[model samples]
Target: MDTEFELFDDDKSDVNAPPSYHAVSMSSISADSVQCEPSFVFSKAQTKQIRTTVLSLIRGMVITPDFILSSVGPTLDACATSLPAAEFTDILQESNIEGHTPLYWAIVNKRPEVLSAFHKFITAYKNDSFHDVRLACMVTNDHTLFTKLSLTSARLHKMERTLNLSLGCADEIQVYEGDTENQFTAKMQITMFQTRIRVVQKLRMEFIAQGRIWGLLFHVGDDTRWEASIYLSKHSLPARPKALLTVEAQNEQHQVLKKEFKLKEGCFLAASEYTNFSIRTCTSTSASLGSWPIFNDTIYMDSNGTLHAKLDVALQ
Candidate 1:
């Protein structure tokens, strides 16, 4: 036998190894490879501290992103309770960085909870003066959420109801000169409704005539009437100088509705040396009537029964 020993790599095994050493190695490897969880988890004491800080900030009226983020829940509650009705109005008037108010932000964010709080505030404030309330109601469409909120809050329901009634009861009226036909025919029309009614009641018209003219007044039922006045100038001018024709309507109580004027045919020489000839309809209260000058011209009536020129003037 040879004195030198031959070493075999495959035979190198520790048959008596203990299992505890292997278990320790595996546990150490797992501990090293595992990732630590995120840090958003709040402890009980930390949560209390956050809530307290938020309440204090809200009470102090500190509205900042850092403040809000730190105490969003409590601050939101405080705004709903203390800042809604009165403070919210001030916030609305004060524009934010985006040229918008808290209400605008609530609308943009679609924050129903915040919107509901503001809606309640608006309804209560509007009760003292409905004008601002009506304006606010019309100001934006974000009120859909507010309306839903109103259904739940008794206070808002009343405010919205009154606004609806006010909008419904308003009425207005408008009037204008229809058209003229070759210094022969003139017509006027009136439109009435809530927003324009008061303005319409102050209307008046003054007609300046250059010659003898015919006038007619027609009253279309519903207490509305149309008036036409005509006149001629005394000069045999080559071209007709423009004439001013005016028409006005009065309200139900005989108050002027609206005054409108139109420039019609050019001034003509008066039929006589008297220098001035004019005529106005006496049937200011009549509903249906018609008038035409001695000159030949086509006449058409508008929806309001005001006469308008349908063809060019024909000098006979």
Candidate 2:
């Protein structure tokens, strides 16, 4: 039988207290209190203790009411406050041996407060720029969790809402939400292909692969053209300096069309420079196409306006 997870005692309803780390001076902080004082000191032992404590809580807690949900955010925040910035980030980003991280569980469980708390912690920790966990897509270990995830992960992956376009809008930008698979691939499905046949001068969708940020850009004109480019020093760099990019889209009447481009550091576009960007930047491949999309949809998009396409890269 499943039991409700308790975060604190009845007397401290508003306080989020995880197990003690046996520090020099430990105090129970209110769940509603702001982050701890900067002058507060944390020992390495305390950091390690809280890390184990939080992971245990994440595994044991089951969703039931908003009270439990509400308590978790502050509990995580308090645990975070006990660690130094780098250790805090490493825990937030590290996965267990099972190939899942605390954030992954929070996301799969559909805990907005947990995600929201993480967003705050990350932003505060890395104030210079925003940081997000680099996940290709959500994955779960068991059938029950997988079934639960299927219902909640849609907003982050598939396209479901209505999209409208005006005919021949110049350099008009529309971002097709991408779905990910193939370990390091992102699929861009353009819904409303009928509209693309008319408008769709340019379209783009972005996803992360192999810890690097990437985007698929499409230009439909006298001919259709697509480019797969990786973001530069902007985020994390690709493990390899070069890669072979494969693009698959649909030709007229849903025929599969495939193309490949060799990308290296020399292929970088110098125009993408931005201040404070980290290292050597983006590489790209663009080619004119006779048609649109190549996902299973060149095999899945209906006779309606949807066209599906995919691009994958080989780490060479």
> Considering every candidate listed, which one attains the maximal TM-score?
2
* Residues 5-122 of candidate 2: C-alpha lDDT, one tens digit per residue: 3232335432333332222122333332224444245455754555566544443332223336656665666666655676666666555313445455465466656655655655
Which number leads on lDDT? Answer: 2
After superposition, the stretches of candidate 2 with alpha carbons farther than 4 Å from their true spots are 1-113, 116-183, 193-200, 220-233, 238-254, 264-282, 290-301
The total of clashing pairs for model 2 equals: 9
- TM of each candidate vs. truth: 0.23, 0.40
* Candidate 2 worst ten-residue window by lDDT: 168-177
Error of 2 at 30 (Å): 4.4
Per-candidate clashes come to: 33, 9
The global Cα lDDT (0 to 1) of model 1 is 0.30
Stretches > 4 Å off in candidate 1: 1-77, 80-85, 111-113, 123-316
